[model samples]
Target: MKQVVAVTSKAQLEAFIDFPHDLYENDPCYVPELFIAQRDLLTPGKHPFHDHSPVQLFLAYDNGKVAGRIAAIFNKNHNAFNNTTDGFFGFFDCVNDKEISSMLFSKAEQWLKEQGATSIVGPANFSTNETCGLLVKGFDTPPFAMMPYNKAYYESLIGNVGLHKKVDLIAYRFGEDGYDDKSVRLKEAIVNRLKTKGIVIRPVVKKNFQAEVDKIREVYNSAWDRNLGFVPMTHKEFDYLAKDLKMILDTDFCLVAEKDGKLVGFALAIPDINQILINIRRGRLLPFGLFKLLFGMKKINGIRVIALGVVEGYRKLGIEACLYASIIEAYRKKKYKHCEASWILEHNELMNKALEHVKGVPHKRYRIFEKAI
Candidate 1:
C-alpha cells in the first residue's frame, strides 16, 4: 500500500531531496540540483522566503521506499499582495504511479485547505520569483541554468490529479545562425540616438556591485509589478538572490541603462552552468566537484538571460531592444554556442514581440497548474 507522510525528520528531508537523483539516474537530460543549495532553500533559517511564509514538505512511501515528494507552501506575502487565498505546491517529483501521485496531491490540498486556502496553484518551488512550472514541452534538450525539467508523463499525471493549466511560460532559444541580428546591426545607431536623448547604455560596474544591485532591485520590482502573479520580493529576499547570482555573473552580459545618473533598466545573463552541474555526480561539490566547476567555467559556451526589464516610464524608448542587442553582441564576441531567454508569460505580447524580433525561437513551454481546494 502507498502512504503519504509529512516530512519531519532530517533523514526524511534528505531522502526527499535525493529522490530525483535516484529516479533519473539513467536519464541524460536530468541534472541533479546542488545538494547544499536545495537544502538551504528548503530549510527555514537558511532562506529568506521562510521569514514571511511557511512551507511543509511531504514524501510518499511504498513499502518503505520513496514513491514521491512535494511541498505545500503558504506565501503570506503573495496572498496579501494579490488579495487572494491561494496556497501552492512545489518541489514536486514522483514515480509514474497514478495512485501515489493522487495521494500526494490530496495530502497537499488537505493541508492547504486546513490553512484556509481557497485554491492551490503551483509546481512553483515557492513563488513565481523562484524556479516554478512543469515542463510540458521541449524535453529533448536539457534545461538551461535555473530552469525546471520533468518527465513527459507529468502533464497527464498532474491532469489526472485535477490540476489544470493556469498559464504557459515560454522559453526562447537563440543559437548559432538562429538569432535575429537586425537589432545588433543597428546597435551603434540605437545607442547614439538614445545618447542624444541623454540616455547612456553601459555595462554594470562590479566595483559598485552592492549599490548597483540595490538600484536594479528597484527597477526589477517596479518593472514587473503588473506581471501575472508577481509579488515584489522583499529586501532580504532580493539580497539573498543577488548574492548567489554574483558568483557566476559576467559583466559583459550584465548591462544597465542610466539617464542623468538614475537607474532605469538592466539586463542580466549568466553562463549556463548546467553544463558543469550535469557532470557533478548527484550535485556534490566536494572530492573533485569543485574542480569541475572551476575548470568547467572556462569551457561553457551558452548563456541564459534570466532577467531583463525596463521601468514603466522607460519602456518605449527602444531601451528593451538595445538591451537585447547588447547581450546578443556580447554573445557573438564571446562566441557562445547558445542563449536562452526564458519563462516569458504567454500573454506578454510586448516582450514576446521584442524577443521574436531578434529571431528568438520559442522552443519550450512550461505550465503552472491550479486546482480549487
Candidate 2:
C-alpha cells in the first residue's frame, strides 16, 4: 500500500531531506546537498523565505519505507510581482515508481490549489534566484556548484504527472585554452572605450558590500523581469539569497559596471564547490565535513558564471562582453581550467551569441515544467 503523508514532525522532515541521499546512493554523478543547509532552508523561522511565504513538505510512503518527498511552495512575492496565481513545487525527489511520483505531485497540487494557485511550476528548490530546474541533458558529468541534477528517468516521472515543459535553460562551458584571445583583446578595447564615457567596471567593493548588493539587486530584479519564468525578488527574498551567496562569493568574479555612480550592470561567478561537497557525504559538515570544505576551497578548478546582466539602457555598449571578458581573463590568470555560464533562457539570443562568440560551447541543459491546475 502507498500513502502520502504531510511532513509535520522532525523525523519526517529529516526523511524528506535525506531521501535523495539514499535514492542516489549508487549514482556516481550524484552530489548530496549539505544536510545542515537543507534543514535550515526548509525550516520556518530559520530561513527568511518563511517570513513572507509558505512552504509545506510532504513524504510519500510505501508501506513502512519512504518512497519520495516534495515541497509545495507559495511564493507571495513571486505571485505579487508577476501578478499571477502560480504556485511552485521544489526540492522534489522520488523513487523510480510512477505511483509514488504521482502521489507526491498530487499532494503538491492539492496544497497549491488550496493556496489559490491556478498553476504549478518547478523543481525550483526555492526560486529562480536559487538553484532550480532539472538536468534534462548532460548527465555524464556531475553538476556544478548550486546547480540541480537528477536521474534522467525523473524527467519521465514529471511528464507522467502531466507537467509540460515550460522552457529550457542552457549551460555553456569554456575551456581555458579554448577562449578566443582576439575576442578578449577586442572586448578589452571596448571596455577601455566605455571607460572614456565615464563607465567603469570594477570588482564588488567588500567594504560597501551591503550598499553594493542593494544596487545589484535592483539591476537583478529589473534586468531579468521579462525573462521566462522570472519573478521579481522582494527585498527580503533577495537579501536572504545574497546573504547565503556572500559566503561563497569570490570578490574577483563579482563585478559591477557603473556609469556616473549609478549601477547599470553586473556579473557574478561562483567557485565550483561541488568538488568539495561531493566528498562531504550527504551534505554534512559535522566533525570532518567542515575540514573537507575548508581545505577544498583552494583546490577548486572550475567556476560558474551564474549571473550576468546589463540593464536595458546600458545594453549594446559592450558591457556584457566586457563582463565575460573580465571573468575569462580572471580565470586565465588564476589557472582555472574551465567555467560554466549557465541557465540562460533559450530565447536569449544576444546573450547566447556572446557566449558562442567567446567559444563557450553549450554543454548542458535544464528545463522547467508547468501544469495548469
Candidate 3:
C-alpha cells in the first residue's frame, strides 16, 4: 500500500530533502543540492517567497519505506502577473512505480484545487525563476549549476500520470575550442560604435554591488517580461537571489552596458560549481565538505551563462551580442574549458539564433509539463 503524507515535522522535512541522495546514490552524474540552502528555501520564514506565496511539501511512503517527495506551490505573484490561477509541483522525486507517482500527484493536485487553482504545472523546484524543468534529453553529463537533472525514465513516469508538455527549454554548449569567434571579433567594433551613442560596456563593480544590482533589476524585470512563464520578481525576492549569487559571482563574467551610468543591459555567468557539489556527500557542508567547496572554485573548468538581457528601448543595439562575446572572450582568457548558456525558451528565435551563430550545440532539452487540476 502507498500513502502520501504532508511534511509537518522537521524530521520528515529533513528526510524529504535527503531522499534523492539515497535514490541516486549510485548515479555518478547526480549532483546533490546543498542541504542548508534547500532547507532555508523550503522553510516559510527563511525565504522571502513564502512571505507572499504558499508551498506545501509532501512525502510518500510504501509501508515503512520512503518512496517519493513533491512540493505543491501556489505562486501568488506568478498568478497575478500572468492572469492565470495555476499551481506548480516542484522538488519532485520518486521511485519507478506508477502507483507511487500517481499518489504523489494526487496529493499535490488536491492541495492546489483547494487553493482555487485551475491547473497544475511543473517540476519547478519553486518557480521558473528558480530551478525548473525535467530533463528529457542529454543524460550523459551532469547538469550545470542551478540546473535540474533526472533519470531518463522520468519522462514516462510523469507522462503516464497525465502531465502533457507545456514547453521545452533548451540548453546549448560551447566548448572552449569549438565556438565561432565572429562575435568576439566584432565586439570591439560594436563597442566603439555604441560609444557614439554614449554607451559603454564594463564589468560589474563588486565594491558597489548593491547599487549595481538595483540598476540591473530594472532591466531584468522589463527585459524578460515576454518570456514564457516569466513573472517580474519582487524587490525582496530579487535581493535575496542577488545575495545568494554574489557569493559565486565573478565580475569578469558579470557585464553591464550602460548609457551615462544607467544600466540598460546585462549578462551574468557563474562557475560550474556543480563540479564541486557533486562530490559533497548528501549535499552536506560539514568538516570536510566545507573545505572541498572552499578550494574547488579555482578548479572548475566550465561556466554557465545563466542570464543575459537588454531593456526594450535598448534592444537591437547589438548589446546582446556584445555581452555574449565579452563572456566568451573572458572564457578564453581564463582558459575555462566549457560553457553552457541554458534554459532558453525554445521559441526565443533571436536569442537561439545568436547562440547558434556562436557554434553552440543544442545538447540538452528539458520539458515543463502541465495538467488540469
Candidate 4:
C-alpha cells in the first residue's frame, strides 16, 4: 500500500531532506545540496519567506519505505502581486513509480485547492527569485551553482501529472579562451563613451556593502519586473539573500555601474562552489564536511555569472556590455577556466544577444511547468 504523510515531525522532515541523497546515489552527475542549508531554508522562522507565506512539506511512503517528497507552497506575495489565486509545488523528488508520482501531486493539489488556489505552477523550490525549474534538456553535466537538476525521467513524470511547459530558461557557457578580443576592444570604447556621461563601472566595495546592496535592491526589483514568473522580492527578503551571497561574493566579479552617483546597473558572479559541494556528501558540513568546504574553496575553477541587471532608463547605453566585459576581464586575470550565465528567459532576446556578443554558447536548459486546477 502507498500513503502520503504530512511532514509534521523533525524526523520526517529530516527524511524529507535526505531523500534525494538516496534517490541519486548512483548518479555521478548528481550534486547534493547541503543538509544544514536546506533545513534552515525550509524552517518557518529561519528564512524570511516563511514570514509572509505558508508551506507544507510531505513525504510519500510505500510499504513502509520512502518513495518521494514534495513541498506545497502558498505564496501570499505572488498572489497579491499578480492578483491571481495560484499555488506552487517545489522541492520535488520521486521514485520511478507512476503511482507514487501521482500520489505526491494529488496531495499537493489537494492542499492548494483547500487554500482556494485556482492553479498550480512550479518545480520552484520557493520562487523564481530562488532556484526554480526542472532540467529538461541538459543532463549530461552537473548543474551550476544554485541551479536545479534531476533524472531525465522526472520530466516524463511531471508531464504525466498534466503540468505542461510554462517557459524555458536557458544557460550559456563561455570558455576562458572563447571571448572575442574585438568585443573586448569595443567594450573599452563603450566604457569610455559612458564615462563622458559621468557613468563609470567599479567593483563592489566590501566595506560599504550595505549601501551598495541597497542600491542593488532598487535596481533589481525594477529591472526584472517584466520577466515571466518574476515577483519583486520584499526588502527583508532581498536583504536576507544578500547577506548569504556576501559570504562567497568575489569582489572582482561583482561590479556596479553608476552615473552621477545614482546606481544604474550591476552584475554579480560567484565562484562555482558546486565543485566543492559535489564532494560535501549530501550537503553536510559536519564530521569532515566543513573541512571539504574550507579547503576546497581554493581549488574552484569556474564562475557563475548569476545576475546582471541594467535599469530601464539606462538601457542601450552599453552598460550591459561593460558588465560582461568586466566579468570576463576579471576571470582572465584570476585564471579561471570557464563561466556560466544562467536561467535567462528563453524569450529575452536582448539579454541573449548580449551574451552571444561575448561569445557565450547555449549549453544547458531548464523548464517551468504549470497546470490549471
Candidate 5:
C-alpha cells in the first residue's frame, strides 16, 4: 500500500533528506546537496530560520520504500512583512504517480489549513531567501550553485493539483563571445561622474568582513524591499547567510559602491562550486569525497552572479551597469568560461535590461505556484 508519514524521528528525517539522492541516482544532471548542510537547514534548533518560522517535513512511501518528500512552511515574517496569511510548500520531490502526488499535497494542505493559512504557495525550502522554485524549463544542464533543479514532470504534477503560477524567475547566461564589454569601456566615465557626486565602487575588504556584512545587509533589505515575496531578514538570519556564502565567495567578484564611506549598493558572485559538487557522490565529504572538494576549485569554469542591487537613491546613476562591468572584468581576467545571473523576476525591467545590455541571455526559468487553502 502507498503511505505518507510525518518525518518525526531521526531516521525519518534522514530519509527525508536522502530521498532525492536515490530518486535521481541515474540522472547525470542531478547534483547532490551536502548532507550536513541540508540537515542543519531542516533541523529546527540548528538554523536561525527556525527562530521565527515553523517548518514540517513529510515523506511518502510505497510499501515502506521512500517515494517522495516535501516541507510545509508557515513563515510568520513573510506574512507580517507582506500583511497576508500565507503558507508555503517546499523541498518538494516526488515520483510520477498522480495518486501519490495528490496524497502529498493533501497532507500538506491539511496541515497548512490548521495553521490559519489562507493560501499555500511555493517550492520554497523555507522562503524565497533560500533555494526556492520549481524548474519548469531548462533541465538540460545541472543547476548553478544554490539554485533549484527538479524533474520536468514536476510542473505537470503541480498544475494537475490546481496550483497556478504565481511568478516566473529568470536565469541568464553569459557564454563565450556573449559578453558585451560596452559597459566596461564606459565604466571609467560612469565612475568619474559618480566620483563627482562622492560615490565610488570598490572590492570588499576582508579585514572588516563582519562590518561589511552588516552594511550590506542594510542595502540588501532596502534594495529588494519592493520585490514580491520579500521580507526583511533579521540580523541573525542575515549573519547566517553571510557566513554560508563566505565559503565560496571570491572577494574580487564581491563589489560595493560607497558615497563618502557608507555603502549604497553591492554585487555578489560566487564560483559555481556545483562543478565540483556534481562530482562528489551523494554530497558527502568523507572517504575521498573530501579530496575532490579540496582539489576541485581550479577546475570550476563558471560563476553565478547571485545578487546585484542598489538602494533607491543609488539607482539610475549607472551604478548597476558599473557593477556588472566590474564583475565581467573580473570574470574575463580569471578566464572563467561563463556566468549565470539568476533568479531575476520576469518583470524586473531595470535588472533585466541591465543584464541584457551586457549580452546576457535568459537560459533557464523557474516558477513559484500557489493554491488557495
Candidate 6:
C-alpha cells in the first residue's frame, strides 16, 4: 500500500531529511548534504526564509516503508516580488515508482491549492535564490556544491504529475587543458583598460567582510533582478548564506569590480566542498565526519564559479571577462583539477557566450517545471 502523510513532528521531519540518505545509499555518485544544515533549513525559526514564506513538507510511504519526500512552498516574497501565485515543490526525492511520485505531487497540490496557488512550479528547494530546478540531464556524475542531483526518471515522474519544462539551467565544466586561456592572457590588459575607466578588478577584502557583503548584495539584487523568477534576497537571507560560505571562501577565488571604490560587480567561486561531502555518509559531521570535513576541505581539488554578475550600468565594460579571467588565473595557480560554472540561464546569450569563449563544456542541464494547479 502507498500512503502519503504531512511531516508534523520532529521524528517525521528527521525521516523526511533522512529519506534520500537511504534511497541513494547504493549510488556511488550521490553526495550526502549536511544534516544540521538541512535540519535548520526545514525548521521555521532556524532559517530566515521561514520569516516571509510558508512551506509544508510531506513524505510518502509504500507498505509502511518510506518511499519519497517533498515540500510544498508558498513564497510571499517571491509572489510579491514576481507578482505570481506560483507554488513550489522542492527537496523532492523518490523511488522509480510512478504512483508514489504522483501521490507526492497530489499532496503538495492540495496544500498549495488551499494557499491560493494557481500554478505549481519547481523542484525549487525554496526559491531561485537558493538551489532550484530538477536535474533533467547529467546523472553520471555527482553534483557540485549547492547543486541538486537526482535519478534519470525524475523528469518523467514530474511530467506525469503535469509539470512540464519551463526553463533549463545549464552547468559548464572546465579543466586545465580543456579551457581557453584567452581571457586569462588578456586579463592584465583588460584590467588596465578598466582602470582608465575608473573600474578595477581585485580580490574581495576579507577585513571589511560585512561591508563587502552589503555591497555585493546590492550588485547581486540589481544584476540578477531581470532574471526569470528571481527575487531579491533579504538582507538576513544573504547574510545567513554568506556566513556559511565564509568557511569555504578563498579570497583569491572571490573577485570584485570596483568603480570609485564602490562595488560595481562581483564573482565568487567557493571550493567544491561536495568533493568531500560525497564521502561523508548521511551528511553527518559528528563522530568521524568532522575530522574528514576539517582536513578534507584543504585537499578539495575543484571549485564552483557559483556567482558572477555586474550591475546594469556596468555591463559591456569587459568587467565580465576580467572577472572570469581573474578567477581562472587563481584556479591555475592553485593546481585545481576542475571548475564547474553553473546554473546559468540557458538563454543568457552573453553569459553563455562568455563561458563558451573559454571552451566551457555544458556537462549538465537542470529544469524548472510548471503546471496549472
> Tens digits of per-residue lDDT for model 1 on 1-373?
7899999988998999999999898998998899999999999999999999989999999998998999999899999999999999999999999999999999999999888899999989899999999999999999999999999997898999888999999999988779888888888888899999899999989899999989899999998987888889998999999899999999999999999999899999999999999999988899989999999999999999999989978887889889988998889899999989997999999879878887889999999999898
RMSD of 5: 0.9
Q: Determine which window of 10 residues in candidate 4 has minimal summed lDDT.
A: 176-185
What is the lDDT, from 0 to 100, of the residue 173 in candidate 5? Answer: 93
Reference-based lDDT, each prediction: 0.92, 0.89, 0.93, 0.90, 0.91, 0.92
lDDT tens digits, residue span 108-223, model 5:
98888888899999989888889988988889999998998899998999998899999999999988568899989999999999999999999998889899999999999999
**Candidate 6 Cα misplacement greater than 4 A, ranges:** none
Candidate 5 pairs with clashing backbones:
none
Off by over 4 Å in 4: none
> For all the candidates, what are their Cα RMSDs to the real structure?
1.0, 1.3, 0.8, 1.1, 0.9, 0.9
Candidate 1: regions farther than 4 A off:
none
Superposition-based RMSD of candidate 3 using all C-alpha atoms, in angstroms: 0.8
TM-score for each of the candidates: 0.98, 0.97, 0.99, 0.98, 0.98, 0.98
What TM-score does prediction 1 earn? 0.98
Q: List the residue pairs that clash in candidate 4.
A: 34-283, 35-283
- The number of clashing residue pairs in model 6 is 0
Clashes of each: 1, 2, 0, 2, 0, 0
Best first by lDDT, ranked: 3, 6, 1, 5, 4, 2
Per-residue CA lDDT of model 3 for 1-373, tens digit only, reads: 6799999999999999999999998998999999999999999999999999999999999987899999999999999999999999999999999899899999999999999899999989788889999999999999999999997888898999899999999999989798988878898899999999999989999999999989988989998997888888888889999999999989999999999979999999999999999999999999689999999999999999999998888889988889988998899999999899997999899889888987989999999999898
- The TM-score measured for candidate 2 stands at 0.97
Q: Residue-wise lDDT of candidate 4 within 259-301, one digit each (tens)?
A: 8888999999999989988888878888999999888888999
List candidate 3 segments past 4 Å from native: none
Better of 2 and 3 by lDDT: 3
Scored against the true structure, residue 8 in model 1 reaches a CA lDDT of 92
